[model samples]
Target: MSRPLGIIIAVSLVFLVGILQGAMASTKTTVIAEKLAFPWSMAALPEGGFVVTLRGGQLIYVAPNGSKQPIELSLPDLYATAQAGLFEVLLAPDFASTRELVLSYACGSEAANNTCVVKGNLSAQAPYSVINTQNIFTALPKKAGAAHFGARMAWLADDTLLIALGDGFVHREQAQQLDNHLGKIVRIHRDGSTPDDNPYKHSQASQIFSYGHRNVQGLIYDEQRDAIWQHEHGPKGGDELNKIVAGGNYGWPIATYGIDYTGAKVSPFNQLPGVKAPLYTWTPSLAPAGLALYNGDLLVSHLVGRRLQRFRYSHDSWTLTDEYLSELGQRIRAVYTSPDNEVYVLTDSAEGQLIKVELP
Candidate 1:
């Protein structure tokens, strides 16, 4: 049985307070390395190391030994308002041959802002030039202000791509509608075209894999269960971690566990029919933005409840057993596990940092 809502909130609050009392009491080793201006998403490289995106529209590479290098790319004019900027960075499925990378960011004229995806290959020469830049996707129903650019990309096993989008803040109703792309999880081919085997293959309006997502900040694939998981920020306290399913609707503005920023009720009930419940919900909002699963057993010691929270599966059936807190006070913006079982995380702040974790 699931825990009570009140208990979950109280326990989360107590955990936060306990961390405050013992701010310097370190359980796992944490190393705050070179800081980036506004690092957003993270992607592991083929040759060992990782690449991060900057909100200022730049790409920074982190070497194996903690050295920093910034790659030069042509940055478009971005609005850089609330929750918008260089949001997500993903490597092309054929990164080895293409050396291509893709990123989502907010861009538009002076009065309006729209999210767009750009794809390019990292140059083989000095400065690491981004060549053959192309705009693969752009938001519909464009409007002003930087908000709800739900743009995170993931590759499916069949080579089709999945993009998570937000329901442009002003159009909360659009989230439940099939005709619009806002507030939706879209499935498309790499060329930005809808696939034929999609849930609503015959209906253009139903390219949506799931709907009513407020602002999905995290998108990841679970190899173990063959399910896609997403987590996003809620209005005030109803942050959520979801197991995404095709053609399903996730209650957003209509049904929520959170309230308005002004303390008004967003919903009177927790579970509503037709709207799916989350696998895990974070009340009081962890502001969770990044997610990645730990796939190994060796380096599991140090990452317990710390940076890389693990959810282990039972033998007969998938039963959740362990839950620990990594006592890291900072908001986790992005998470990715390395090929060697090391964990990497980026904190959310102006002086945001990239930290690595391994078994002690």
Candidate 2:
């Protein structure tokens, strides 16, 4: 080859490499907010902002420009300890017009803690504080303990809300009984009244949509299918992703794929009559937290696994297609998709962060 031709080829190669590098850099993560206090959940505001909840019972309003301001929301009964605390925050479907929002948190004193949901309105002015807050729903038979407070919330319809409640750890057997609210998915109207058509409306277990859930943390409503998707943390290994059904029995302690933390078998049978099987199970337990369906894909944030997983549904089954952000090695507690389809994740740490995910 001639010298001039060699020089031209080398220059072209360098130019191509630089172009490739720039393209890769275009799809990168940007930290929107950092140094948070154990952020558990976040919801994007309709007007281009966010309302984030911390496990230590604080609410932070974040502006689009990355500025953070603390919002004072009164919660005199908030019980913040261990795995209990403020959990999920979500805006109403008609939030743009009503400025209404909802949140789930551990309420009551430490000796009698349980999951509770509050509905309130957001102020329009700066600081964007919460006002007129009312405890719309509270799990029954409030048991003691800081673990297993399944306080995730999802809007099943325009007028209905679904709140996931855990077994309260020590009362796992009550999950199979219909006399109480532990280990169940409860559905209620916006005013915290039982819907007229609930499956258990005529029974003693009114408001119970499903039972036998261990400690659900993630929930999402699929409008296309008119279904609810949820996930829960198991004892040692059996994490589950389930399609919730009315009056369904999930078989937590009665039929689990996990053993106790002490290495004792939780149940002898993994399959039982009249119990619904999980759509998916993680043997080693991913500690799945946030769940969202965006662009025909389900995105899951893992606390113990330390990754963001994308699952695609096709032919009535879900398959894992992508994994991301594992290099950061942070415990992701929540995932939210904005109206513009941008993904945001909250890390679970003293110096937690709100990260925006850029896709290629």
Candidate 3:
């Protein structure tokens, strides 16, 4: 009887260990929520909630638990097509003191349309109206069609605004021309005036902070480096991670490590005399869409896979250090980090999802 009892106890202990191991692995990845449709961009709000933008021109407030409240906000008539629509939603740095929110979307009259940014007040009550809606900036050379609006916004510490514009597919060569605002990152005052101190404010066709970008979908200010960083999609295999600099040019159709969609070579070489090279280039394309620097301690230091890519900055160069795939299989559209170190990501799809990275 004693021998039989010992065997039973041992078998139970092994089974318990296996169950515990499996649970830990699963807990490492908990899906806080899912089933959102065409979610585009996200802005972190106070008290641990986020306001997300949908391609259909709606803003939904999501609590930390993933419960959502669609704020019935009014949007200007927008022409959303292939890759254009409502782009980014962000709170002005002075939101707590001013209650101001800035929105970037594609807008045009029946004849011509381009990407534009507006500033307005956000109310929590019914019928959230964007009072004092002011059109601050619009991309130059309004090209027809709703493709490559390149409408993303970031703020510099000095209270200046940076807006990224896509080279309206009307002409790819326009990317290299400073006279055209398409395919360039422009820096301006909060009121939409070019800054006198801008890198190219004095040159002809130079409201451009940086140039030669294809479609810069991801833009953010990396606080630790005191620099702005961006990631843009490549034609075929040369998706890139870039450390943006004022007055600098990032070679787009010119010095790509990618190929045209037709599977032909994109550029003959990888470097050009004046254009900047990417800090890191992905071959065969991860189809990267969002970028963030992880500030939390729970993430292990050396895993570069997908969803999120983290870099370590040395004195002269950056090395890829970490990456993690989100629960949603779709492309990551945007990434935001709050003051308390919570990382938020928006996935692209008809039914998009907002995910939070929590460390156990």
Candidate 4:
């Protein structure tokens, strides 16, 4: 009832070869806007510009002319501490007319906080702001501390929203539970309603798409193969890039290739029965933070690794086709490809930047 792996890989090859007559990429970078505040994620606009999010509760619009304008927003009790902040930004599928957009941010006090998603309409012109904001969805059972509130997001082919969540650091075992939203990918309608056809719609939490992820930050939906790809941070080693399958259990503390920061073993086993294995594992910890599809390949940006690595599918798995942009010497926070097939990168720093990548 399912297509074979060989078939899928063959089709993917065709797609790569068909794009721009199978052009090989060369990396060239240019900084379009700079001096950002802890930049986390960015989105390329349907119009002629871009929007970048700083973890410090700010959204700055980078115009085509490279001028930056702070978009006004009022996220109540927006937490900006300890591996948390306002996260990803995504334009609505019909953004040209509706002007609606979504946001994922850390909400509540450090004593009790959760990952939250909100929908808001944008002003058309100068002094651009998100107006009429409303909370669409919020992760339940708010936890203490500011670590591992996974808020990365991607859109499904059916136009549903997918939000990735973390295991609350000390609560790593919850990544295997079903009653709560911690350490899972959740699917909901744009209006924050759960999708009826979700794999676990009847038994598990209606919002959960998959479970067992640790601090997932990179999530993308690939239309070419009708697949969702994600990456997450590992403790001291074993950062992973994974292909998400519905109802799949990606073992975290129960099955890890990495150890605890204290030099203790997190798990006795790195592979287990009924647990999905990673397609690729970054030993020694790449600290991969962002993932994007470039022309038919993947562009993975790293924080600790401090570089961008490109991988192409070959010999039945992702193979490193190229690597570049380490010369800029900044922690690459995120990489995004525009609807028009343009590339962009966000550098993470006190004085962050929105960079345009020319790959032709």
Best by lDDT, which number? 2
lDDT of each: 0.71, 0.89, 0.72, 0.88
Taking all chains together, each candidate's TM-score versus the true structure is: 0.82, 0.91, 0.84, 0.91
Model 2 agreement with the true structure over 1-360: per-residue lDDT tens digits: 999999999999999887556433433689999989999999888777788999999999988888999988998899998898888888898888998999899999878878889999999867678999999888888888898988898887666999999999989998988878899999999989999888888767698999999999898898887778899999999999889998999998899999999999999988799999988889899999899888978889999999888888876567776677888889999988888889999999999999999755
Pairs of residues clashing in candidate 1: 166-183, 167-183, 305-324, 305-325, 305-326, 306-326
- Is 2 or 3 the stronger prediction by TM-score? 2
Per-candidate clash tally: 6, 0, 5, 0
lDDT of 1 by residue, 236-292 (tens): 888777778898889987888888889998778677898888766667765666667
Residue 151, candidate 1: alpha-carbon lDDT: 82
Off by over 4 Å in 3: 1-33, 109-111, 124-129, 203-206, 296-306, 326-328
lDDT of 4 by residue, 196-294 (tens): 888889865788999999999799998988889899998989898899989999998799888999999999999999999998999899889999998
Where does model 2 exceed 4 Å of error?
A: 1-27
Model 4 lDDT, residue 70, Cα: 91
By lDDT, the candidates rank as: 2, 4, 3, 1
What shift in Å separates residue 202 of candidate 1 from its native position after superposition?
4.6
Candidate 3 residues 1-360, lDDT tens each?
699999999999999887555334321444455776778778776645677888878778777787877775666667676677788887899987777888899887535777888888877443344577788888777777777777878888988888888877656678888787878899888787888888877666556899888877778786666878787777777877787988888987788888888888778978899878887777877766665556621121111224555556776467654445533345777666677777666667787767666533
